[model samples]
Target chain A: MKLRLRGVRKSFGSKVVLDGIDLDVGEGAVVCLIGSSGSGKSTLLRCINLLEPLDDGVIELDGLDIAEPGLPPDPIRRRIGMVFQSFNLFPHLSVLDNVALAPRKVLGVPTAVARVEALELLARFGLADKAGDFPDRCSGGQQQRVAIARALAMQPELLLLDEITSALDPELVGEVLDVVRDLRQSGMTMILATHEMAFAREISDRVCFLDAGRILESGPPQQLFGAPQHDRTKAFLLRVIDAGRLER
Target chain B: MQQEPTRRQRWERRQRRRSIAVAALSSTTALVAVVLAVPRLPGYRKVRAAFFDGEIFVDTFGPLARAFLYDLQIFAWCAPAILMSGMAIALARTARSPALFPLRVAATVYTDGVRGVPVVLWIYLIGFGVPGLLQSRTWSNPVLWGSTALIVAYSAYVAEVFRAGIESVHESQRAAARSLGLSNTQTLRHVVLPQAVRRVIPPLMNDLVSLQKDVALVSFLGPVEALRRAQSFKSSLANFTPYVGAALLFLCVSVPLTRLTDHLLQRERRRMSATAIR
Candidate 1:
């Protein structure tokens, strides 16, 4: 396993967001978390990234306790990249600069070398023509692709994608998901929090249903989507189907 | 193939021309009324002789103009100092490290304390009070002390502006940078400050415009700058025209800066509206 989370808990004053969460992501596996808005999927991803302090429990990356007291998150963060739902590419930077920033600044790579690698990554994502364009000039799908390319530039052991396509238009959704599918084919370890039940069913190696800050049911995508054992999981899938989000 | 103008388009063009003609006519009439009526007032001649004497203006203009360069010099030096200190204070205020808590508190106190005091009083206290207490002739130079006071006083206001700019950056940008493994300082330097500083250019220019005029406040400490020169001319020649000359000099500098700030503000607004569409 590349990542192990056991009994992870997080709370904001009186409100608990992630309650005693436990999960494991093996090397080159894709785990998709599907649930309603307040189900703690995004929060769990953030906790894994060490962006939010875990109120309780252990997060072990390669058997090293990452959530221990005062371990500087910067180095750990470099090893695990995250792409937010909003596609938070730095607005002031050009598409090329956005992808090149971390390699040049954090990794201490020379600017010329970083630019070459960034261009290669951008070209891989079919964004070669957008190297000089600002984030505001790019379409939503293009921006999300650049965001994924930016995260990939770090060469992380694991990537956390929090609702990456949720903010995209329905017509633009496939392009962004195509990039994810390609990443999966390249054997990148990824954890995705998504509202797209159909895409989760299609692309995920494992699908976990989250409800009220806990994973209620988790299994292979076929079993979890086809024969969910829990009533809440079944109800959630029914609602998704009713909303025309998931195909029968 | 050519097309004739639409009937509504022709009517709209005529309306626009008539509106322009009305505007021109109304403004000219107002200007003519003011010009024809002002001189007939009972005290017009006395007021003009006292405040707008052509001879006094011509005589004192050179000296006052020369004195105005000192204001520009003070502005040139103080502007950079204010910007640097303002950024420092703003950074201190925004720092998230627990170790920097005291520094943040100190920055807050300094901003509040300095902003509470009037600039003129700060100048008097620093320029005269400190010099008197030190009892050193070298330290008693009001120009140096007065400029210091201006920089100190103005930095507090500028720091708030900078802090506002810094805080205006969305939290997501910082998260994105931090997730890329950049340290907090690196994220701030590389990502946050660049966007923050760009957003604040127009407001910073406004502050600089205000500072350009407030540079004259240093004359209170007896620096013999433009306002002081105008004062001397007023006392000696017993005419206020030299003061008008000094005011004209101030207007010459400030109006252009004010216009530039407005232009930048408009351009930024346009850019924001254009980009926000996506």
Candidate 2:
């Protein structure tokens, strides 16, 4: 499914978070959104999933009007699954149950069928052994992978990953990225808001640099990373690369 | 590492054993003293007359049996009524509806106001005052009036307990349930309430225990329950032994329940801790 956002504007009281934002992800394309903190990258991703109500905008998902205020949004939301930064898996539920919940409750799948599908997804994410375990018992990377598997259990057409690896430890980040890389190889349409520049360049077909609640530049990985046209993009790339080195 | 036991450590261990032994000896001695004293106490003659003399005890057994049957009947009828009414009021208030605000306020006021006063006052009001004010002598049936009073008072307290239980669930659980496409009611029934009820089991069991004790208070209305029977035996036999007998009867019913509640609460705490570790 193709997701297109147009003239999106969201504000919290007086502070403008998303100001006249616009972006799009073509069918089966991996679009990476990169920006520093407080740049509204996460808010933009939340708008796509309708987790945050948009103040003003049109978000079209697979030709369906999700941004229309009165429209029933569950049908659209069901087709678009989201993975949050915190890996918001239900702590009270087992790994298999967390993945099975949406399918059984929302999609009305039978319990046995949902469990089978959930186990298969967990196996794919290398979490089959942890199926009976709760999220808190798992490592950060394992939890994030289970979260991704949970989203996939909904059989969504488009996956919205909002800094999924940002909350992981340095050593744990690679395992979660591997899952995303596997998803990329499987031709899943994903819009990833992330700080992992190299991963974005490695996996994303296009990279969109956002600054101050707007897209400053967007293009193929080679042009954006190697020969960026915008000065803001260059500055951001330099700062990020410098910060990355300092962390190491 | 061969180390001599410190004097304080050895003394502490000895003290612990001494206290346990003292407690056991004192309890047994107290039990024997009570048994010996019972025959010489002021009411022993009358207690013997009631139990062995077969005068008041046999004559009152019929009424006592009838009262016991009536008590069971009242519990059967009133428990569900109180539980349903209390649960409905609690769930409705927590439903977050504007219309239920008045009901919630009324329920709160009722619980607080009624519980603040002695239950004896409520019994008198329901049993005597209401009938006098309504000018209906038929409302003089002590059984009906007394049960009414019990239900009203117990319902208030139970509603508060239920409300606290419902609120004990974390807000995130509700959000998660909603995100799963369950409606508000479905979320409550499937997700929120089950967890909340589990959390409140200990308190709810305590309420049940207190409620059972409160049943004895209904004897004041004069239908001759265990307490009333004992009271009458005391007056006729002129002694306190019947009170002791009634107390023993109450302990027989309540002690096992208290232990069961404690056991269940302990198990629940262990389960919660294990889940939290996960």
Candidate 3:
């Protein structure tokens, strides 16, 4: 499904986090949103899923205006799955249960059917063995993979990855990125809010550079990363490269 | 590197020390107090005989046994009612609505006030004051009044317990449920409450144990159950033997429940630790 955001604005009290932002996510395309901390990258992704209410904006998913007043957002949200930074797996539930929860509870699927689907998704993420275990029993990478699997279990047409690797240990980050890379190869459309520029550049069909709640520049990854059109994008890229080198 | 002591080993050492200290202190104190109080024992016996005796034991114990049976009957009947109402109220309040403010206030007042007041007073108020106002002479069954008071008081406390349990679940869990398209009520019933209730099992068991012991407080109005039987037996024999016997009966009933509570708590702790390790 195509996602279009026009003139989206959101603020918490007096702090304007997202200011008159516009972007479009084409069908089956992986779009990476890059920005510094508190630049509203996460907030914009949250707005797309309607997790955060937009103060003013038109969020259209497949021609349906999700942000239209008095319209129910549930149908829009069901098609848009979100993976949080914390890999928000339900600690009390088993891996299988976490993945199966949305399907069984929301879609009214039978337990057996949900389990079968959950196991298939887990198998894809190589977490089938961990299905009976609680989320706390899994590594950060495994948990994030399960989170991805959980989103996939909803059969979501659009997936939102909100800095999924940000909370992982350095060694664990690659495993989670690999899962997303696999999802890309499988043709699952995704919007990724990330600091992993290399992975973003590698996997993203389009890259949008956001700064201070506005899109600085957006285009194909090669054009945006290798031959930037904005000086701000170049400065941001230099800072990220320096930070990445320091981490290494 | 040396391995740390297992939890069981640590618990065992702590238990040993506590039991030894309790035993030594209680034995010494009991011996000294008994020696000093022996001279006054005869005076106490004389006073006790005046107010209580064998016939009183017969009069109270017999009827108390009957009343206890009645109390149990009432508990069985009202347990489902209390649980259903308490759960419904708790869910309604947590899910948030215009009614939440008043419901929460009422719940807070009911639990805190009723729990703080002596159950006997509540029994008196419900049985004597309210019924008297209604001009219902048949409301004199202390057993019914006592059970009603217990249910009302305990339900409030349990409802709060359930509310806390529901709230203890992380907000993320609710968000995940909502993202899946489950309505607020469905999220509560399917996602939030199940996990919350599981976390609260040990505390719920503790509450049940407290409820069992509190059943004895209902003995104030008349000999309704075991307490009355023991009191009557003491009066008949003009000795403390029956009271001692009744105390043993209470211990018999409550001891297993206390042990069950401990067992459940230990199990929960283990489950938590296992989860934490992951």
Candidate 4:
């Protein structure tokens, strides 16, 4: 579960989103990426999951380079699950089918077994009764939870969450975050892009401050938030402080 | 016990009653005028005798009904082929592979080339030409050839409908599925196509409605469907009662189908709005 990105670079036509990024995510550790908007936090997670093609880099999951050309992304992707900010649950599928589809279709698990596993997962996520409902029938928080359950259904080694709670209402954010906390307690490896400063400081093992597609600083949460070495980190933390997000 | 209404309520009720009375009186007056005026009009009796002859209609009904079965048969046989071929053409047009470039071009050429020419012309050319080429072969029926022409021509239009449905799925749907280890094909099958087809059902049903009626054009190749039966009676009886009967039969099918399509469209709209409420 050791995820390494060495000299990872990504761009969109003229804009460079991830500029020579380098990082390491240890097994069973939670790495929180904190930054302002357009800071490449989401893009980095996408690159790591092989959802976006990297211009240059070596992304190694347990020392196997996954970013190499001709290395099929699907096999690598099955081991690494990603939950998007938008929830991206298939609108046509029922909540249970959304969770069970990948396991049944890609993993070659039988439908009955997959449905049983899916129901168990839904019950664990407190959406057991809503298994038959479509994604649109659920609240944003519930849908986000289902999206996480869908990614987790594959039993992936590494989970990448891109601003998973930013779309939820203030009151709804806590329920989704609670699932993330439970995942952390269970020692599932994760890297998440988040604007929830308090949540990040509470749950993260290491915090990486990405500014303009580069990690300005990486350290323990207390050091990065309480006593930041980089000036940009201080300025960003000051904004968070003004916004009343950071706790003493 | 009945209570006396308030003055304003009484006035409103009176106005409503008066309006309903006026509407009924006017409609009855118009009907009387039309009935009185028709017999006085020149050539009315002869026209009615020719077009609405009961005996001719009774004579034509059985054959026309049997002939319509051919139309239904063609639709049943060709509709599935049309759907499959149309979907395949749509997928080919949308495919991004360099290896499929030739196929994409060919599909593009077909939809564009076939759509511009009139469908009847396709029926004429393929029906007569193919058999002429294959004179030695046993398969030389113009009706079969016409059915083939209908499938080829209509499939282009249907493919465009299918393409629109496929593209209507949001880009995020693809991203989410692919990120979950599903390949592009799996993503399309499991995620995109299902939603797309759901959204496009109303329009696709509309196309099928048109397709059902277009089955008549096969009569040009002398398949003896309802329309051709009408034409045959036109020549045989020297009257138009059979044509009117045929027209009524088509109305029997298309009107119900049109109403069903309308109901489906409304249901789709309601479902969309309900989902949007969340």
TM-score of 3: 0.83
Residue range A1-248, candidate 3, lDDT tens digits = 88888999999999999999998888889999998899999999888888788899898888988998767767777898999999888776789988998888788899999999999999988888999988877899999999999988988999999999999999999989999989889899999999988888889999998988999899998888888888888888888888773121
**Per-residue alpha-carbon lDDT of candidate 3 for residues B222-241, written as tens digits (9 for 90 to 100):** 63576666666556656664
Better of 1 and 2 by lDDT: 1
* C-alpha positional error of residue A132 in candidate 4 after TM-score superposition, expressed in Å: 1.1
Please rank every candidate by TM-score, starting with the best. 1, 4, 3, 2
In model 2, the runs with Cα more than 4 Å from the true position are A209-212, A220-248, B1-83, B96-156, B220-223, B268-278
Docking class of predicted structure 1: medium
Q: After TM-score superposition, what is the CA distance of residue B92 in candidate 1 from its true location, in Å?
A: 1.4
The TM-scores, one per candidate, come to 0.94, 0.75, 0.83, 0.90
Report the CAPRI category for model 4. medium
Candidate 4, residue A107: CA error in Å? Answer: 1.0
Candidate 3 i-RMS: 1.8
Worst-scoring 10-residue span by lDDT in model 3 chain B: B269-278
Chain B superposition TM-score per model: 0.89, 0.72, 0.67, 0.82
Q: Say what the RMSD of model 3 is.
A: 5.2
State iRMS for model 4.
1.8
Models, CA RMSD each: 2.4, 6.3, 5.2, 4.2
Off by over 4 Å in 1: B1-26, B264-278
Better of 1 and 4 by lDDT: 1
Worst 10 residues of 4 chain A by lDDT: A239-248
